[model samples]
Structure formats: C-alpha cells, structure tokens
Target: MAQKKIGSVHDLQTILQISQALTAERDLDRLLWLIISACSRLVDADRSSLFIVDQSRDELWTKVAEQTTTIRLPMGSGIAGTVAKEGQTLNIVDAYQDQRFNPIVDHKSGYRTKSVLCMPLINSSGEVVGVIETINKKNGKAFTARDEQLLGALCSHAAIALDNARLLRQDLAHQSLLHELELAHSIQQGLLPQSAPSISGWTFAIYQSPCEQTGGDYHDFIPHAHCQAVDVVVGDVSGHGVSAALLMSTARAFLRALDQDSTRPGQLLEQINHLLVQDMADDRFMTMVVCRLDESGHVRYASAGHEPPIVFRTENGYCDENVETDLLLGMLDGVGYAEYVLPPLNRGDLLVLCTDGVFEAVSPHTGEVWGMERLRELVRKQASVGASALCQKIMESISDYTDHSPQKDDITLLIAEKT
Candidate 1:
C-alpha cells in the first residue's frame, strides 16, 4: 500500500523548536529525555525510545521507561538495533509480522506493539550514533512517510547534541584524574627526607630522579636518639607510577616506626617484610638495603635482594663489592634477612648505596646497558671528591652514557664518606 502524505507547516515548526532546545542542552540525560518526548509527539505514537550505540560492548543501550533499569540489545538484534547497524530507516506497519522485530520486549511489558518506526540518528560523518524508535501510532494506523521525514530531521539535530555532551563529559573526567595525580605526587614527595642530616666526621650526599611525577625509589637517614649511630635506608619497589609510589610510602613508615638503636639492620628489615607481606598484593615486592654507620667508621648493613653497596678504599685504590643478598620484601612471610659487618672504613673511604636504575640505564643510540663495571670504574676514579660532589659526577656520567635517552626507571643514590 502507498504511504499517506500527512505533511503540515506546524510539524516543521515543532522540529525547528526541538532543534533549538537540543542545541542549548548540554546534560546527556536531559537531552535524551527531550529527544524521546519530541519523537513521540512528532509521530503521535503510544511510546518512544532512544538507544545510543555502545561500540565498546557492541550493543545498543537505553535508559528510562522502566524507571531505574537500563535496556541493552546486541547490534542487529532488534528493530532499533537493526536501524542503528544498517544506518537506515525502518517503518513496519505490523511489527509482529516483521522478521527483524523482536517481540520479547512486548511479551515482558504486556504492551502490544502493532507498528514501529525506527530511524537511525546519523552524525555529520555519516556514522549512526543511535536510533530513534516509536511504536503503535495513536491514530490506529501505521506511521506515514511524512512522520519518518520529520523524525529524521529531529534525529540529525539530536546526534550533534549527543556528540558535544559526550565530549564535554570526557574532557571533564580527564581533567579530574590529572588533578588527583598531581595531589598524589605532592603527598609522595613530602614523605621523603628534605635535607641531609648534620653529623660530625661524616658527609652525606643524596639524590633521587624519578622518570614520572612520582616514583617507587625511596631513601632516608634516621639518627639514633641515644647513640651517635645513624641508620641509612634505600629501597626500590617493583614497577613505577602511583601504585609503586604508594607502596614506597607505606614501607618508609613501617621502617621508621620499627627502627631502634638496639635493633640490628637485619632484624629491622625482617619486621618490615612481615608487615608488607600481610598488607601488599601478591604481585608487588620491594628490594631494600639498610646500613647503620657509627662515628668511629664501623658499619653494619643488611640487604633484601637489592644491589650491593660499592665501597671505595682510597688507600688501596680498590672498590670492594661485599654486600650479601637475601629475598626481597613482600614476597613471603617468615623470610630471614642476614646482616653483614663491613671492614671498618679508614679515613677517606666512601660507601655508595644506589638502586639498579643507576647502572641499568640503557643507551638509545647504542642499545647497551651502562653496567656495574662502568659504575665501579667511575667511583674508583672519583673517590677523592666529597660525598655530594661524587653523587653529582655519577649523575653526569649516567647522562653521558645514555646520550640523553628517556629514563625508564627511578634513579636514587646515597653516598656516605668517612671524614
């Protein structure tokens, strides 16, 4: 049967008014309601719906009609979904007789759906973003060709409005996330030692370089209240970014609270490890080293799978690599850490503690790792300099070796020189 031409000047006016309203509205929910209301009024239908395409899930979703519950259907599964998938207008006089129409919704809601007119809401790029569906014409007749033309015009405006609203929401979410990261970075930085501690007969030098706003590497100097001994700690948490930085902060707090003059370095680390294993996730872990240095140049240190300290003996003109290894923290409970006493440092001997990033930095041009041998040679040559100056020299060497490649990990160095 040929379609009835029921065109009217008032219909054109209604579409123009709806377009103006949609252009001004930015809220997505309100905009969707406006579109659905407009669709029902324009076509004189019993009910109407607007389903937005969710490309990520390969589905079409709509909210409203049932109050809180959202309706989702696979692409090309039903009348509205088929219109969205094909980017075409579907006008069926008898919805039950049509092969593309799914009557499950009618069965569930107990509402008879005799006629359905589904139109694709296409963007300026000719891509269908959604579908405008209207069911059961109020006049006891199928929707005419004039109704389809009016709905198509309204849908064009609705698509543009939806695109703008979605983009605004995405930009706002991105800005909010960036602000949160900035706050997190600030808090992590405040947890670190601000300045080197002042002590006679010892010069301390420290530096930390993070590839991002925050890093997993941590270092601190905690002095004993009763004795002249000072504890130096350097830790590297696995991975980078916010999660690693959070773990680094937690470990720092645990170590500081457990630290005592009577407690050995190994005993302190064991306590911290047990706490971490209980609190942390299975994939996470930390490698750390703790060393206590006295005014008399006597030292006791312990390692938890961390890189051993490089000792520069000024008299012998040799570098002593004597740090014993053990299992890293947060891997398993009941793990034991061993303490090793280094040969007492004579006058002018320097001890260097660092994370793996100090030596494992890769060169972009050469594709080579600046290994331990290069670091040992550099320390031996720069043994005569003060602790602070030697740290600066090593950083310079690392910069030169990588040829200004982007740093992939956190770099931390703590140098203690016996004066």
Candidate 2:
C-alpha cells in the first residue's frame, strides 16, 4: 500500500501508457473511467472520481463514480467542487476534519474517507473543465506534494483529451439535429399549397420567407369545386423553428380534413381552434385569417387574433383599409369567430394578407421598423401592377428597408387581385 516515488523510470513509463490509453478512447464515458482508473492506480488511492462541469446547469457531475452511480454537486460545494471552482489543489489528511467535506456521500456509500486529494482539470484555454478527486490513500497517510505534481500532470493530459472528445460529441449531435431539421423543412414546404389557386377573374400571388430551416408561418388556398368558391388562409404559430413548424403542419392537416363540411369561414375557424387548443402547449398559440371568395366576387372573411389584411381600393383614391381584428386561435376553447363581409373588389383592386414578419421587419442600422403605414403606402403605389408583381415589389421594399439584415422571423404574404 506504500506510495512509490513517481520520479522513477517505471512510474514515468506507466504515466506514458496511461496517457496513451486516455488518448485512444473518444467515448466520454469510457474516457472518464480510464481517467479515474489512472488516478487511483497512480496515486495508490482506495477510490477515485472524475467530475465534469455542466456549464448550463452550473454543476459538477460524475458519470464513472466508484459505485457505478452518477453524482451531481453544486459548482462551489464539496471538496471536489471547491477545487474545481478555485482551480487549485486540495490535500486533506482527514476528511472528517475538513469543513468543505460533505459527509452525506460517505453516509450513503458507507465508505470511510481518510486522506483526500482533489485537483482541477484545466483545458488549454486555461478554463477548469473538470476535477479529479482521489479518496483515502491506501497507506492511510496524507497525499504528498509529489502526489499533487504527478496527478496534475495526468490531469493536464486528461483535460485536453476530454475537451476534444466533448467537442466532437457536441458537433456530431448538432449535425444530426441539422439534418433532421432540413428534412423537416423539406417536408413542411411540401405541405404548403403547391400551386396558387387558378380562378377566373382573379389572380393570386403567394410568398413565404423563413429565417431558419423551419418557420411558423403557413398559408394555403383550398378550392371548393362544388360551391365554385376558394378558401384562402394564412396562419402564424407562436414561435419560429421546429416547434412552430410541427404545429403548423398539424394545423394544415386539420384544416384540410375539417374544411370538407359546408361551414362558413368563421364556423370552420372555430372548429379548427378547438382542435388546436387541445394540441398546442399553454404558452403557444396561433394567429389566423380565413377568407372565402365566390365566383360572384363576394368575399367573406373571419379572423382569429391575426393582423388585418390591407385592401387597396382603386375606386377610393388608392387608399387601403384594414379588416376588423379578433381573438387569436388556441388561446381559449369555445371562442366564437365573427365573419365580416368586404365590399366586392372592382377591377384592379387588391387584398393582401400577411404575417407580422413582413411589416415588423427591423432595420439593422437604424433600429427602426418598416411599420404598417410604410407597407400600406407601398401596397397602394404598387396596387395597379399584376398580383405577382405587387408581391415582388413589396418584398423588395422590405429587403431595402432592412438592408438585407438576417431575418429574425418567418415572413409570409398572400396577394389576391381582381383582374
């Protein structure tokens, strides 16, 4: 049980062999076990533990404990934690005499602790990534200064190896997640209306821009062949990215399947709202507007906490009117939606529905928003153009206003013009 002088040639060779073993293993768990094994054998300790830092939780956790059970401790608590926090070495001759020692672990494990030596594992960037704790030296003596030096050398090698392995694991996980998101984005794009609804006397233009691989914005035009009417809907989920994209997909499916009945846009929205409330989380909801246009040029629309569409009327001195707003979807069950009738559009009139991302876009340089007024002005000026040209011109204006800064949210707009 006597500790051998680490300056000996055999001990140096053993250290070299341990370093090789540590470097060979890339799996974090196996590498951790190797580290503890090397520390126990090199220091002639009864048991050893390696605690890795979890910066997100600000805690130290051991995956390869002597008892084969995981242990978590606050960053600055206990002997191991103190060493990790201060980035210093601690050698305690008597565990019971040390104020920093927590006896709860000893009580639970039924292990009598005597001498303790703990040292920080600092990465190349001079940051403490973890700690090495060796408990109860086999000879029943305090860990010597020589033990600290030898263990410190081992920790230096272990830290760099551990950091590299951790980075690789994180990169692999991130790549996997990105691949899944890209696949989901592809699937989500297919869920949207593949082609704009082709109706006589009407021209439709649709556009969507997602800041991330996935977005919360959704739009679709479903035509009723029997009724000779088209249902146009635009909805925005609470947040952007994966969660919102999933919810958007669900809503799209529900809308398609449930719109088979001959209900008005308001009644259909109420039905969709009840279904969304059951599926959405409490913190999440959606803003939506649905409008049905008949061949006779009659347009009846219902809104759910969504922004009003801009109606550019050439007959009214090129002015724009915003439709009445109402409560959003998925916020409350049994909420009724009121349908409003818009004046039948004459030739060259425009109806534009959009999510907030379009007008609320912030200018990167000036920190000013391209507000609703600017959007309304742009629509009025461009209203005389074809439906596709109008949507394109508005998108160009937004790009110029924001100076092409990275988009923060999903942008969507649907323009329907009476030709």
Candidate 3:
C-alpha cells in the first residue's frame, strides 16, 4: 500500500501531543506503553504493540501491552519483523493473504485480524531500531494511506524517546553502583587499627595500603589476658573488594573473641581455623601470622601459610626465623598448628611481620618484583633505626623501586623493636 499525503488538522495536532508526551517520559516501560496506546488511537485500531530490536540476539521482543509478561520472536519471522528487517512501512489489506503474517497470535488472543499497519522505527543513524504495529482498524475496513503516514510520523518520535529512556536508565544504574562502592570503602577503612599500640620499653610502627577501595588485608593489636603481653595479628584473605573485606572483619572479630580464652598463638589459630572452616567457602582461605610479645622480651608466634617474620638482631644482623606453618585457615576443619618460641629478644632487636604484598610489589619501569631478598637486605640496613623510622624507610624504598606503580595488592607491615 502507498502512503497518502493527505492528513487532517486533528491528526497533526494529535501527533504533536504524542511527541511531547513521549519525550517527557523517562521510564522505558511506561514510555513504550504510551507510544503503543497513542499510536492505536491515531490509526483508529483495536490494539497495538511496540517491539524493540535486539541486534545482538537478532530478535524482536515486546512486553504484552496489557500485562507484565514479555514475548519474543526472531527478526523477519512475521509482519512486524518483516518491516523491521526491510526498514519499510507495511500496510497490509488482508492479513491472512500475506505469508509473512503469523496467525498464532490471533488464535491465542481469539481476536480476528484483517488489516495491519507495521512501520520500522528508524533512528538518526538510519538504523531500524524497533517496530510499531497497529492491528484491526475499528471500521472493519482496510487501513488507508492516511493512517500509514500518521503512524510513521508518530513512530519517528517514539524511537528517539525510547533511546533517551534507555540511556537515562544506564546512567542511573552506574551512579547507584558507584555510591555503593564508596560506602563499602568507608566501612572497610573503619575496621583497621587507628594507631599503633603504646607498649612500654618497645617501639611499634605499622604500614597498610590496599590496592582498591576495599581489600582482604587485616592487622590488629589485641591485648592479651595477661596484661604484660600483646598479641599482634596480620592476615590476608584470598581476594579483594567487599567479600574479602567482610571475611577480614569476621576473622578479626573471631580472633579478638578468642583472646580472652588463650594467648597462645598456635592454640588461638587452631580454634579460629575450625570456626572459619565451618562457614567459609571452599575456594576461599586466609594466611596469617599470630605473635605474642611480652614485656620480658620473650616472643612466641605461629604461622598459617603466611610469610615468615624477619628478626633483625644487633649482633647477628637479619635472620628469617624458621616459623613452622600449618594449613592455611579456612582450608579444613580440625587442622593442628604449631607454635615456636624464639630466643628471647635482647635490647635493640627488631621483629618484622608482613604480608606478601610488601615483598611482591611490582616495579612498572623495571618490570621487577621487590622480592624477599631485597626486603631482608633493607631490614638489615635499617636495623639501627627506631621501629617507626624503619617502617617508613621500608615503605619509601618500595615506593621508589616501583616508581609510583599503582599498588596491585594489599600491603601490610608491623614492626616491633625492644628499645
């Protein structure tokens, strides 16, 4: 059927009203409903439907005009699909005579169909982005050329409105996600220790940097049942972001709760492993070092698949203590842990506990990792400095070696020196 140039003043006015109304609606579903309803009234049709093109799937999908349910059909499968595929206006006089018309919809709805005005919705880029189909003219006659022209104009406005609504929805979702991440970052920061512990006859310093807003690394200075000692814990969960932060929080709480029962590093770790194994996911685990330091300079510690602590002695220089590691926490239930008592610390000795992040930091310029050997050598050189100064120097060295490469993981360092 050919399009007629003739249109009434009323039809033009109606189209203008629909264009303004469609542009005002930002919600995609509501905008689609308004488009279909207005198009049906403009063409004096009994019903109408709007189908959006999904180029990736090569399909046309539409929500049922009167219901929340949706229906989909392959492109070029029916009258609407044909118009969309060819990017042409379809004015059918006899629906059943057209082989492209599918009667299954009519049979399912129990409504007899005689004429259809299907038009492709082309955007500014000349791409057919969707289709609009008006069904069964009310007068029981073949739809005229005047009806086709009116619907085509209306569909042009509808296409732009649909595209605007989709972009708005995407922007809103992105903003919502950013807000959530910001809130999570704030909470994760709050869980960390605010300041290093003030223990008499000892100096303490700590450095922690997370790769992202939230991370898996955790460190805590827990007071022991015996007022003479303090337990220092440093651990790393398996991953980053909110899940890992949550796991770190849980581990901190568990460790603090067990502090009242026992200060023995190995026993506390064994109990924590049992609790974590009961709830943690099978693929997730944590590596940690738990050390208890008393005022008398005695140090007892345990490791759960964590990095060994380097003890810098005034007389012997740097030595990596042979702390025996058990299975990583959350790996299995009923795992046993061993505790090692180091030779009592003398005056001017430093004990360093750190996560792998400190030693594994990658240098962007040289493409080299700040390996454990460099860390040991640096610790040996800085042994004479105060614990606080030593920690700052180590962090500065890493920063210079990496040449300001973005941190790739969570880096943590805890240094204790007998002054």
Candidate 4:
C-alpha cells in the first residue's frame, strides 16, 4: 500500500511537470530533454534513449541527443525494438548475454550494454512512432514500474510538444520577419503624402500597402508647374525592402525636381531614368505612372513601363481611359520621357492607378487570376464613391478571391479624381 501510494504521488508530479512544460514558451526544449534524461535516473539506470516510429521505413530510428547519441536499430532487431514492437516494457538484467541484443551501435559508439530497459511510445492513436530504452540500471540494479510510469507519461507529452514546436517554429520565424517588416513599413508610410494639399475643387488621394506589410510599391503627390499643376506619382520599385524603399524615396525626389520644369511626361521620365540608371542596381528599376493634373483639369502624363492609369469619364458612364506604354525607368541612361496629353477633363472624372498585387490575386482552389478587367469594372461601378471607399472595395474583392493570402507584391492606388 505504501508502494502504491508512492506510485500515485510520482504520477501526480509527472502531470505537474507536463502542465508546466505546456504553459512555458521558453523552457519547452529543456523540459523535454530533462524529462527523458531523468527517466534513467528515476529508474536507477546507466543511460536512456528515446525513439519515435518512422512509418515510411517501418522501423524505430534513433534520435540521439548530443549528450546521449542513439544508434538506429531496425524493428525487431534489438531489445529496444522488441519492446517497441511488442508495445510493452522490458527489464533485462544482462543485455550482452541476450542473443537478440544488437552490438553494432555499441561497437561503433564504444559503449557497452550490460542491462536494458526499453518501452514503446504510443500516442492516443495507438500508433507507435518511437521507443524509450535505458541501459545498465546504474550499479547493476534493474528498472522499476515507477520509472516506466514516469517515463511513459513524459514521452506522451514530449511527443505532442515536439510536434507542436515544429509547427510553431514556422510561425515564430514568420513573426520575427514581421517585426522586421514593421520597421520597414514605418519607413514606407513616412514616404507617402503626409496630408492632402490645399487646392480648391480638387480631390487628391494615395494608397500603398505590401501583401506582407513591406514591398516595393509606392505613391506620392506633390506641387508641380510653379504650383499651377499638381504632380502625381504612383510607382512600384523592382523589389521589396529598405533598399526598394530607399529607391522609392529617390524616385520621389527626382520627380519633384522634374516637376519644376512644367515638362512633358516622356521628357520628365527620360531625365529621371538617366539619373536612376547610374544610381540603381543591375536589377533595380522603377515602373511609374506620372501625371500633371492642372487646375483646369487638363492632364498630361507619362509611363515608364508601368500599368496605365484608368481615366474614368463619369459623364460617359465610367469609360476607362489609358495612355500608351513605354519602357521602364532605369533600364538605360538618356531614355526618352515623352508626355502623353489627355483630353479636356470634365467634372466627376476619376483616374485609377495601381501596382501588380491587386490584379494578381488567384483563387486558392482553382488558381484563377482576379484580373485587371474585373478590377476596372469594380472601379467603374463604384467610381462615384470617394477614394477610400473605392480602394476598400477593390481590396475586399481581392481578399475574397485569394482568401486573404499574402500580397504577392506591394499594392498602390492613386486617385486624381476631378470634381
């Protein structure tokens, strides 16, 4: 009865250790290793080993701790294998004397086996992935049921924890990247238009967001034509990160300098391209749609291998207007930045521009693109709405299609709606 009471007490202690292991975030690995190592001490053994089932090989592979490396033993080959295959515990007083004992690993690692205690590690599914085997029993003693009970409980929780750690590790890695990305995101936000310009009868808006909180997309609005025309820039850098963001800042500065000339779109681009080609990396380039929207609503724009802005004529039932395509900036020095002239704009005209992310959303199940045509229809049907609402609706559509998958690239939308 005293022994029985001691066993119950030991089991409770094991349960508490499990609870503590589960609750802790930092000490889980130590807890698992400590429990398995303590199995031999608790049972008065020389050393211990743990193994999980490998269904593919139909064998019990050794998972060696650096402090206690185990050798791979085939199923039914050694004392550990027999115990695991039988789903039972074995306490052998003389391992070397037993013909079933495999001497190969001991021969390799230079450890002798005198006594053995091996048990199967079975989960709730009744499938065995591993075995826990101990040796020598320290001072010629043998293992006890108490040791079996303690180690059994430890193994159950350890297996679960190990599986969880593998999965949680991925999440941890992503979160670490996210934290770094937040720093980049802060820098990106600072580069945007801090606030709206003070202009009469003009509505200005800009939006940029990465699929993963940081990417190469950007947008800005600035003074142009001696403060007579407004310079609007929407662009995507060639890649993501602080590097791309730095390039974006450079682009903004160059655009501002070019805006001083009251220049044509193509001319402004040619000049910026000449400067960027010298500064940008071999792979670094920018796709930009720059436009000058004047107080009278006459628009002149240029493209540098970027998606054309959709000029929605509200009076004509949301007709989407597009200009000609051109080469991307930074592709070569002395490139032309010719400007594209727009027709005289009327009241309630909307210009929609964006990066590649919004149009690249694919259905998770069917893998179909959400496409730019659908995006235009959404804007056309909803162009009368303000800038914020239009962007929100388009984002919602993309999310619905992709199930909120990571944004493949940075997304930007700039609205130069003439009221």
Q: Which candidate has the highest TM-score of all?
A: 2
For candidate 2, write residues 1-419 as lDDT tens digits: 24454356667898899999888898887898889999999999989999999888999998787874789999999999899889999999998999999999778877788999999999999999999999888988899887887898899999999998998899999999999998999999999888797887688999897899999999998888888889989999989999999999999988999887847989888999999999989999999999898877778899998987778888874654655877888999999899899888888888889999998999998898999888888887777787899899999999999998888889998999887
Of the candidates numbered 1 and 4, which has the greater TM-score value? Answer: 1
Sort the candidates on TM-score, descending order.
Answer: 2, 1, 3, 4
Candidate 1 lDDT by residue in tens digits, 146-183: 88888888888999998888888889889998899889
lDDT by residue (1-419, candidate 3, tens digit) is 12322447667888999999999999988898899999889989988888999999999999945432477989988988898899999899999999999988778877788998899998888889899988889999888888888898898898898888988998999899889888988887788889988876577899997888788999988876456888888999988778888899899889888877974789999999989998799899999999888887888888999986788888777665565777899998888889988888889998898988899889997788999888888888888877989899999999999887788889899999997
lDDT, residue 296, candidate 1: 86
A best-first ranking of the candidates according to their lDDT comes to 2, 1, 3, 4
Clashing residue pairs in candidate 3 (N, C-alpha, C atoms within 3 angstroms): none
TM-score, one value per model: 0.90, 0.92, 0.85, 0.60
lDDT of each: 0.88, 0.89, 0.87, 0.74
Residue ranges of candidate 4 with Cα displaced over 4 Å = 1-26, 49-133, 140-150, 157-187, 199-201, 207-216, 224-229, 236-286, 294-298, 312-323, 327-338, 343-349, 356-411
Stretches > 4 Å off in candidate 2:
1-7, 314-320
What are the runs in model 3 whose C-alpha is more than 4 Å off? 1-12, 52-61, 72-108, 112-131, 141-149, 225-227, 321-323
Model 2 per-residue lDDT at 174:
100
